[model samples]
Target: MQQAGIPTGSTRPFGYKDDKRTLEPAEAAALRKTVERILTGASPRAIAADCNKQGLTTTRGNGWSKETVKQVLRNPRICGYRSRKVREFNPETGTESVRVEPVLDDDGEPVKGQWSSIISVTDWEAVTEIIGRNPEPGDAYNARKYLGSGILRCDKNGCGSHLRAQKAPASRKKPEGFFYYTCPDKRSGYGCGGVRISGPETDEALKMLVISKHEEEAEDRQATGVPEEWEGENELARIREDIDDWTERREQRLVSKERFFAFLAKSEATERRLVNERNEWRRPVLRAKGEPIDLRGEWGDLDFVEKRAYVEKTLLTVLVASAIRLGGPVRDRLTPIYRGED
Candidate 1:
């Protein structure tokens, strides 16, 4: 007999109806028990092994396989939720079944509409979160393009720079229709006595060690791995630790209670400092690193919070020096990192 309208090499006629369907209540109950067993630490492979050993057959009466076991686990029918979407192939069109799954919840969980749910809402959430990480189509994976746009600093002293975007001719034949970034201040801005060079020229001039810092950060994250959530937890733990230590010292009479209260009064100040530091570490280091540039689409596409993140990542320091010389030495004085001028 054929299952899911696929030819099973069996002598089953098309459109032949069978009273014994696999999605019945009894099958659902059995499937639920099987799912519960698996969730309680039984591996899918092991469960498949046990099912095959017991001479149990899938809907097609075929021997159990690990893949089938996984499909069953993911199926929602066992949990009394019917799957809304079922595959129905058009024999004439030779088209595959289309997905009709609905957004299960606001968190993007899949809801049961036709087949019963074998997994709980929580387990479903975990699986969805894992799967969601797989990058989708149209997803460009480069950090440097946008982050380094305005932030890359020119190491040249007097020319301590801000990025300048200008269109200049690349060659005689082609009008180089590309964004060329350079140190605006270094090239010919205030106090910058250094020679103003094009972005492509300066890229060649910059030291490899300085340029590679951003690339190293990106590569290291890919290699060792970093979780997005851990950063917040780490900061929270540090804050709590500091608070606890202070409290303990005061309670144990090691530090006077008055001193402890005084410190408490400054808690908001400490919090502001910590918040600034958090923003700093997460900030992108913008410098030419011979890395692939990744401008993340248009600015209008980005939301406000993301725009702020982009600003924090780029736009390093604004150096203040004496006067710009026509062709003299640039000072190396480092000024305050611009946090946006008032």
Candidate 2:
């Protein structure tokens, strides 16, 4: 079974039939449409919602999700490559671990699968490049309880460390306990010297701040109006030119391999940054046209992960000042730095 290029599982890829030898026409078509939509600037979240509306399900018969759609887009199997998960057992510990490894042909390239390709290699690569530019979501394994753990930054002088949420020490006044966001450096005795802020108060402050910003943006759109077009082409073109120049230099042996790779990394980072900035420009236009979300009403109902995603999308950094006095005044200490504005 290991010698064969088949996945050692019952589940087949979404665009393929259970037999794994035939293409499911409808699923294949859906995959193609998904890639096309992504290239045309539709987000994974939008695509997933559309899939659900159309009664589409994953290969495992589950509802479509952003992560699911992203996985499908990133899978090399769509290009006819064979992917397999190999499980190895350790004799000493009697433990097993599984790792995904691509099967290779005689020439050491990825093995072509028995099934027909749903998407061409070029199109698959293009889709991957576009998706790679988007910011990835935080890990869901250890989902945060407080919304501000990673997004909030300690604003103590000479120490701008990320704030972490931890359960506040139990006291006679409130034995049930509470959470607080404190500088990890201070907690670890690294000497950040930052003050801890009440988690519930910070959350409320952030919600209000987000709502206020949203309202302000709405008014601004009504007055000045959203931009008619994205002006990011020039910057993106410059970055691509730099990438090509670096590639040519590497090919011509003008730059060492290490330097070439470093230049490529920097260029790619800049490209992703510029692409995100371009997306931010489009978001306002979408909001004006009533296509994007307005989180005011649904804010309280969201879970920690959902709230974190919203905060990350809207704000770049939340600065936490020293909480000199607790309770209502703590809300005034928080300063939200919105994206594109900073």
Candidate 3:
């Protein structure tokens, strides 16, 4: 008897035929397009919505969902690797653990299948990294309810604590409680000087900053004649070419092994950085198509979660400065670090 190679299952992955031995041209194209969109900063939710709007269905013939889109993007099978489920019994715990292990070739690398690959290994890895950077939805208490709750850095010159939301006690002047973003140093008694800022006031100031910076970016784009529909596809292509060139150089013995590895690491790092920047660059275009940038007219209409996502996607960091006067208001400095701008 001979050992089985690829599984002869009735069902196949989305980008392959039912026999799993050939590429379904349309499906493969769709998968590649999705990867390109993701590299340009399309969120899973946005991609899912677009798929459904276009009447695209999953491998199982169901409408696409965010989780479904994410699972498809994360699937190694799309890269032409074969995987199998292994079950292990745990006698001590009276349980079994199941895991998917990729089949390896003689070279100890993941075995390539007969089917075509829809995405390159590098692009797949970049998509995975981008997905990992996004925050997951939370439950009741853990949900983001205030802007800058998880984003604001400590005001102390050298302290690195993140500010957390604290509810002020009810009083005669204000029966309802108010929220303040206080430094974790004070909350945890770490001995770093404390800083607190009014949540509403800080939120409003941040909104203004977002609006002003967005306008500036728009003007810059107009002056530079950058296309509104431009994505980072060209830049990604250049980075991929550089990576291939370095690999060829190392293979041809034109560079020392140590130097080759160092340069390869730097090239990969630059690729990741470029992917992030491309995503940021596409964000404004996506927002303009989907949601209105009503920072002034409809600012209060957005919920806490939406507002937090907006801020996190737009700004890299918000550094709060402690009040100069003992009883003065705390000040914050914004860094419009999105779109690879310093």
Candidate 4:
């Protein structure tokens, strides 16, 4: 039924009415707006909050959540497509798990559903790619309120753990806001537990460093020339999809080894080159309209998600040390390494 374009399920999707196939005007509109906002750099948490405020609920009549928003956007059904479960057995566990993948026809084309799409295929892919990668945004608790929460690392005696935002009382060095990017101690069952830096100060320092690096990259691009928009995103998606399909076919014994290996050698080489190209064109900060902006001034306006995404892109890691070990000044206590740097 789904392959023939008829939407089917135990319960109608969030944007559909009781009939299951027809779109509910209000719900569909909200879904569309949410997709647009996410593509424009709005975090899932922000969108989920907006939905809950507007009295929107999931198909199960529960409040909106960041994970729910991501799941809905990643679903191809919103783009008028059908998906099926690919069950694979785990050898070690002696159990099977399943993955929901797009339903493909015999000709290797996606099965188009009969229901109308809430968003275009292009927009849908972009949404999925964004929500799916760059550290794969976790649940609400992991939504990230601090800029350096996950990006900053503890460099205490090789006890490397991602620093988290912790509350602290006012101190002489950190006089305001009363927060620190403190490393979890043995009580947390991990980490050196000794690294604690002023939260507000660390955030400000990292922001400026990222902005400076971004500025330098932009200046370098001026001579070499850069594209107006990031290209090959859709192409990369297609390549990945093709690779998955090829592997699935082999696992299912639908294709012989000779055919699979022939495709793999060529596909893997192409995927590698595209990945390198993407890394080269990486922009650490992008707010809206995909244009250059004044990072120093506009940095405060961006939400936590955007700031973290930008920082993670530009720097592989920010290895932070305690005041005693990292002497000199606040800036000297940390080392920022650019992504792709050795």
- Most accurate candidate by lDDT: 4
Candidates in order have lDDT scores of 0.44, 0.72, 0.66, 0.74
Error of 1 at 78 (Å): 3.7
What would the per-residue lDDT of candidate 1 be over residues 91-201, giving only the tens digit for each residue?
A: 897866533233354323344433324445443323323223122333234554432344445556545555554566666343455444545543354434332334443
Highest TM-score scorer:
4
Q: Candidate 4's residue-wise lDDT over 138-165, tens digit each?
A: 3324367788877888988878898889
TM-score of 4: 0.54
Which one wins by lDDT: 2 or 3? 2
Name the lDDT of candidate 2: 0.72
Alpha-carbon runs more than 4 Å astray in model 4: 87-98, 133-200, 204-310, 314-342
Which residue pairs in model 3 clash with each other? Answer: none
| Cα-based TM-score, every candidate | 0.25, 0.47, 0.52, 0.54
**Candidate 4, 151: how far from true, in Å?**
6.6
- Winner on lDDT (1 vs 3): 3
Q: RMSDs, each prediction?
A: 19.3, 9.1, 8.7, 8.6
Give lDDT tens digits, candidate 2, residues 158-226: 887888887866562543557878887655765385668888778888878777776777667667665
Kindly state the number of residue pairs that clash in model 4. 2
